[model samples]
Target: MLHRSGSGGPAVVFLPGAGLVGLDYLNMHNRVAELTTTVLYDRAGTGWSEAAVLPRTAAEVTDELLELLRAADVPGPYLLVGHSLGAAYARHLAQRFPGEVAGLLLLDPFHEDLHARVPQEVRDRLKELESQERPSPTEEQLRFGRSQMAPLFASWPETVRDQLIEHHLRVAWRAGLRESENVYDEVAEELRRAPALPDLPLIVITALGRDATQDQLWSERVLREIHCTTRALHADLASSVPRGEQRILDDAGHGFLHEDRPDAVLQAIADLLHRVEQ
Candidate 1:
């Protein structure tokens, strides 16, 4: 595991979205680390981390994370900032190891019951992914995908953009595809089995782009419905916890929530840290 620590108060650990290494979150990490110690590490099979046995469930991944932290001698009562699928892991960690967690900030998270909440078409696509063997992306495919995502990384420095694209194409894509195919259902089931999270500072940041219609073609209907469903689920999740708060960032997509709205993200962290200290 590759670990980078920044100096300060309580540690803030970042859990990257599926397939991304800790470096993928450099923009947000740099911002958070300025105020507090920050920890970012690659999961097994991603970035510099060596591959581990596959088909790992959320509970298993959580155990591995705890072991990594302990082995590294990183003291906890940590503030966890999890993006996308990582949010599921953060929630599981908090549920199972409440004392170790100080706060939770979930960025555009996937709901444990997302499969049930989304439309049939969306569910069908996810099932298709689950049934098929993970496809290796060709150079042409990678280039095309990167081109489509160009606008998102336009704000990042040239070097960071180049490095992110290289990492995504060469290392993250295949591992992410395997994880999605092998353990998605198991992870969802694991989250379903988790008890409600303990009372703590919680922030659920949801991206609700005003022009989401422009982003879809064949999946327009499914996408619109999914957005509504996602918002509702997050609201319910926030309400379930004592100190939970939900914030919607209009015109923000999943990537832009941290990259574009760093201020909002930092504010949420600041607020959570203040509450924890109090």
Candidate 2:
């Protein structure tokens, strides 16, 4: 767990995406740390954290975070920021324990109904990404992953980048698969049943790679169609909350939108903070 208390204001705790622990957002946390207390921690079995028992449920994970915060005396109300799969956790927290969370910033989040709303082609592309064929990383793949990730680490200091790469290499692929296979769908269902989030400060950052100018291999037209569908979902989500705001980052992909455009991410957080303080 990496936690730093700032001078004042509610603490900000980050929830990472599938296969990544808290350390992946070190740069973002450091920037937020300059303004308020920040907490970034590995879920069990990821990064520097120890292995947790198998079949982790959404309620179990949420309880773990609450226990951690209480044990560490990190007082709330908190600003919960979640990415990808972690966004579900954040929403669960806000709905299940509204008194503790002051606001939410969802970074390129995954909505439960995404599959139903997206085109069949987009759904196929998503299925391709969720392939269960690949489990552990081969030595060559690990080396390649590190090299490809190197440029993205340019903003951080060398020491931090080295540690980040090392932690990335330690990702528990099989465990992640098990957790997702067992828990993600169930969690999404629970969220679907849960009450709508209270009218609190909320910002949804949607990555709309609609321009097809990125270096990705997918054709521009296909990418645009997928992202356009996704953008509509994000807009609907933002409309659900009274104070929710939506920002679309054109030509950006999923997972690491913050790494690609830290300014946009930070601005969203800053905007939420403004509302949180108000």
Candidate 3:
């Protein structure tokens, strides 16, 4: 794993969404660098970490994370921050290693089983991403052909948006789709057995809207594509996890962290940390 360490206090071990590399978490890393120490590492085969020779299960991913911590000598009482697809792995880690995890900050995480319930179009897009047709784009890099993805970055500022697009551009093609699927498969199981975690502080940052600022390019019609309502996923997670709290950022879409309002993301972290410390 390629680990990026920021000096300070309680370490924040960041995991990227879906197939993204550890570099995807640079925004959080830069901000948290001064507040507390943090470590950002690519999942095996994705970033700096070499590819694994065998298929991996959810249990194996969690175990690998534990091993990385030991290998890097990252002391515990850790604050885990995972985004989108990465949230499933975070939940597993907190459950499997209760003594090591201090808190969890889940940013618009995938609801797995809920994912299966998503609209056909969304699911189709996901499938396309998984296909061998082309490599997946980084959260940052949506270029000439990829400009269509620019709408997703609409909520983020200039600098944050640019780096993310560049990061997406730099990822290896094979690593994006193939490895992402493996993680998705593992996430499927995590959904089946969403373990009751420790009493450690847990904060879920939920995305809930198609903000008006979005251009005509964005469809306004209500999306009833997902079989399960977003509300249902929210309820299931709240019930299944221990000491969990949900905070919805009104009018923010799926890419809540990178959109027009980064301060909101920053504030969410600051607040979660404050609650944990208190």
Number of the top lDDT candidate: 1
User: Over the full model, what C-alpha lDDT does candidate 3 score relative to the true structure?
Assistant: 0.66
Candidate 1 per-residue C-alpha lDDT over 1-278 given as tens digits, one digit per residue, 9 for 90 to 100: 54555776578988877776787777777777778888888778667688776556788878889899888878888899998888889999999999999999999887878778677777777677567775667879888878876776676679668777777777786777666654447788787788889999999999876432236432567667878888999999998898999999876777446776788889999998899999
Candidate models: Cα lDDT each:
0.80, 0.77, 0.66
Prediction RMSDs, each to the true structure: 2.6, 2.9, 5.1
Superposition-based RMSD of candidate 3 using all C-alpha atoms, in angstroms: 5.1
RMSD of 2: 2.9
184-274 per-residue lDDT for model 2 (tens digits): 3677788888778988999999986432223363666766666777788888888899998898887466767777788998888888888
Candidate 2, residue 14: CA error in Å?
0.9
* Residue-by-residue lDDT tens digits, candidate 3, 1-278: 54556675467888776546676556667777767778888777566677674345667777888888887888877888887767777888887778888888887777666656666666676676556366455445445525754665554467656665555556543455454565546657764675667887777877766533223222444253331356568666765566677877665765445344457766766666676787
Ordered list by lDDT, greatest first = 1, 2, 3
